[model samples]
Target: MSRLSLFAPDNFPLIQPGQPLLPAIVDALTQGGQPLADNDILVLAQKIVSKSENRFIDLGDIVATDEARDYAARCLKEPRFIQAVLNESAAVVRCVPNVFIVQHKLGFTLANAGIDQSNIDPSCINEEHRELALLLPQDPDASAAALRRQIRDTLGVNVGVVISDSFGRPWRLGTTGVCIGCAGVEPIRDQRGQKDLYGRTLQVTMPAIGDEMAAAACLLMGEASEGRPIAVLRGLEVIEADLPATALLRAGNEDLFR
Candidate 1:
């Protein structure tokens, strides 16, 4: 690609449960004078997609089991919150005071199963609920595909979609955006047996393109207080790849970190 561009609308609205996302995105883009175009990829924060999908849980609604209570005691968190995490997790990786990491049912090993409490609007939350938490979308890959389809149907433009979430690596200090779901994008680009600039044969050079794109767009969508939840990445040539984000996950046998 000759050049890359990233654009985020300055006035992205605070998303609410069950809200439709496409119209808001289009309105924001049109207002910002950066209308959507063919081949443009949209990188979205997972929170917005979850909110739109109404993937919310009331801490008051949870009834902690004995196992969940034990985990809560160790993590120094609420039993109900721990119970919610336990319900969402397929396996518990580790638990410590104020930190509980688990492998989500979606096969991602992340902290608290990607359930978060930050950036939720209290005004939008029902008064009956004591504390509300947002969970990741049920099927993020399907959500991405649905979004891509919506754009194509409504605007008559083919585009790519990426649902990104913040993740912390065990060896890394801070968290960065990662591709949890994607459509019309290549999750991994295999460069094995390809020749380098000096005509040297290359091996073991597969790049996680989806994660790279998500991370690059996240530089515009800040983690906190940045209202900009969506970003447009232009000039990427990976469109129509139609690969799922699961391709980014390493197979169990190839996972040397664990």
Candidate 2:
């Protein structure tokens, strides 16, 4: 029986702008004496990724078009960022007062195109810096690949990496972490055709283990407290080796909700 533990380092500092998260994480793991091992999964918060990549946007510097302002007025969002997100979005779903669901160019149908306001310096709120607002990486898979390479090079160990973000589920009250990118791990574990104790064949038993691991990491890497933006998940099944997150994405036509 492989057990899961959510490791949180005490009194970690806020990730500064322009800081690389991978090195910090490697240091943390070393300090914790929880060295990365084969089959281990490292779950990281997207905010850290965004911060490391300098993804932020200044609300004041953006000039909102009439259409953007009108939509922002209806959605109750900041016109500048909302407009930018809208411009980047491929499709706009719901545009009610103060809320919107947009499909980004990355094929992710998320709120505000994943634009975030939390965990940013207030002083930069007025600058027109595209670096502040992260454009979804051109290829999340590629990002995961790069991180995996870096981690391997830094630690001299083979391990899995997962980049995650918190997202609200439709009809659900709270949010949970979802894997936006991953490397060296099978994101989904399909159990269909497997038999149970009673010899009953398991069907529809695919588990989003990557998402589950991400959510577990988020519990310790809280949005506010804990300051720990990275977590190490040890003792996973060895089957998770070299697989990426795209293997977990449900086809839009097969999904019932989208």
Q: Which tens-of-lDDT digit does each residue in 1-258 have in candidate 2?
A: 657665766555566666777767767777877767776787777777776666655555568899888888899877887778877788887899877888777776778888876666655434444334555555666677788788788778887888888787788878888888888877888899999999999988998888888888888887775677788787666464566777766667887975
All-Cα superposition RMSD per candidate = 1.2, 2.7
On TM-score, the candidate that comes out on top is 1
Error at 55, model 2, angstroms: 2.1
Candidate 2 segments exceeding 4 Å error: 123-138
TM per candidate comes to 0.97, 0.87
RMSD of 2: 2.7
Computed on alpha carbons, the lDDT of every model, listed in order, comes to: 0.92, 0.75
**Candidate 2, clashing residue pairs?**
55-132, 56-131, 56-132, 56-133, 57-132, 57-133, 75-98, 184-242
